[model samples]
Target: MFALEIENLSFTYPDLTPALEDVSLQIKRKKKTAILGANGSGKTTLIYHLNGIIPAQQGRVKVLGQQVDKKNMQEVRKAVGLLFDNPDNQLFSTTVFNDIAFGPRNLKLDPDTMTRRVQEALERVGIRELAERPPYCLSLGQKKRAAIAGLLAMKPRVLAFDEPFSGLDPEVADQFREILDELVEEGATLVFSTHDVNLAYGWADEVVIMKAGRVLTAGTYDLLRDGQVLKEAALPLPLLAQLFRNSHEQPRTVEEAAALVEPGSGRLKAVDSSR
Candidate 1:
């Protein structure tokens, strides 16, 4: 079953400029999807529509089979967890434990249940040690994890992450990606918007390219292997993709490229000839 569906979706800002135009897409259950676009491409606008934070303003938006509207607000919000692009916007509680516990507490979960959920959520993000520290004192990466823990405590079926890897060192970004991958493996439907093409290529099961407030292409990794979609989105494919483009082979991932590079394939042949 599809976790989220947007049909002919469009939205306009208060200024009357179109933020999204004729955007239609589907996020399949338990699949990790990367939504990539340049700024002003309506990536953030589209993510908001998924959770009914910003209403359709024009087209239809549905979550887990229910069309999003005032009537479904409670259900939609409960089912779709959005980790905001800025952790500061989401974390307001005085302490890390309180921040993580805030969501479940609002739901009126019993004390024991809420406590268990908060701890598990913290551990899931690998930030259990920081549970007592003030959120403002935590590192940027730690703050990001705290925000994710808050969403996990809510137990949403579909997880929507906005720029999950932004503003972090290479090592921290790698760690964050690993956590997201683990979440996907455990059956969370994930949709995240990012400007990083290489990370999207390495992590996502499917890719959706957006530009000028519209969807450019939606396809599997194989379909986006060439630089075609990336180029259209004003992004570049990873180094591996560049090698594959020059060689005319289909190696989507780093591991796949390593295995597919026969000794006679272009550069490998050149190296062998030089030796």
Candidate 2:
């Protein structure tokens, strides 16, 4: 089952340049899909159509078997939860718990079940201690977690994120990665956008590159290893890809590279660690 199936989808804002043109693709279910593109590449515009945030101007969008239209807009939204680039846009309740509860509350689940889900979501995202804190007083990382908790409470089939790690510090990003790793391992279907080729290489099971409102390419994560594709999208090859350009043994992550560079493997001597 595909997490998303989009066909001939096109959208253009009034008096603005086209944001998406003839886009068509299917994201695999229960896997990490990363859309890579520079600014103005329409990555954000595309995911918005996955939910009902941006109405379809041309073709079709289906989320987890439910066709997206005015009739099934709510169902499509319920199937796919979007995590915005900015936490401020999603968090409105005074306390973090209430902010997270907002989505589940709308579902009208029995009060006991709603409370259980809300608390479980908070614990899953590691924000239970901050549940009573005012969202405005929390740190940015905390706010992001709170926002994600809100989506988790809804239990959507697919979770879409515009730019999950855009503004986070290195330490915070590391922490965020841990949470995402757990989710992905538990078979949570995710579609997230990022301009960071390294992040896409390390995190995504599938990669989709966009350029000027068009899909430049889409395939397995190894597709990012192709310098030509990245070059066309004005992106560089991932750091690991660059490091192993001439090598037959390609390592996608630091852990893999380190394992391949064991005592006297000779591979370690050729690499310039300074990079």
lDDT of each: 0.85, 0.89
Off by over 4 Å in 1: 255-275
TM-score of 2: 0.94
lDDT of 1 at 265: 48
lDDT of 2 by residue, 1-275 (tens): 78899999999999877999999999999889999999999999998998989989998898877778999877877788899999999999889989988888888889999999999999988888998999998888888999999998998878899898988997888888788778877877899999999999987899999999999999999999899999999998999999887776678888888877758755563455555
Candidate 1 lowest-lDDT run of ten = 266-275
Q: Quote each prediction's TM-score.
A: 0.91, 0.94
lDDT of 1 at 220: 73
Worst 10 residues of 2 by lDDT: 266-275
| Candidate 1 lDDT by residue in tens digits, 1-275 | 69988999988899998999999998888998989888888889999888889988788988998999999898888899998888999999999999999989989999999999999999999999999999998888999999999999998989998898899898988888788788778888999999877777777888888989999988875545657777887877776666656464555567766665555643442222222
- Residue pairs that clash (backbone atoms under 3 angstroms), model 2: none
Off by over 4 Å in 2: 262-275
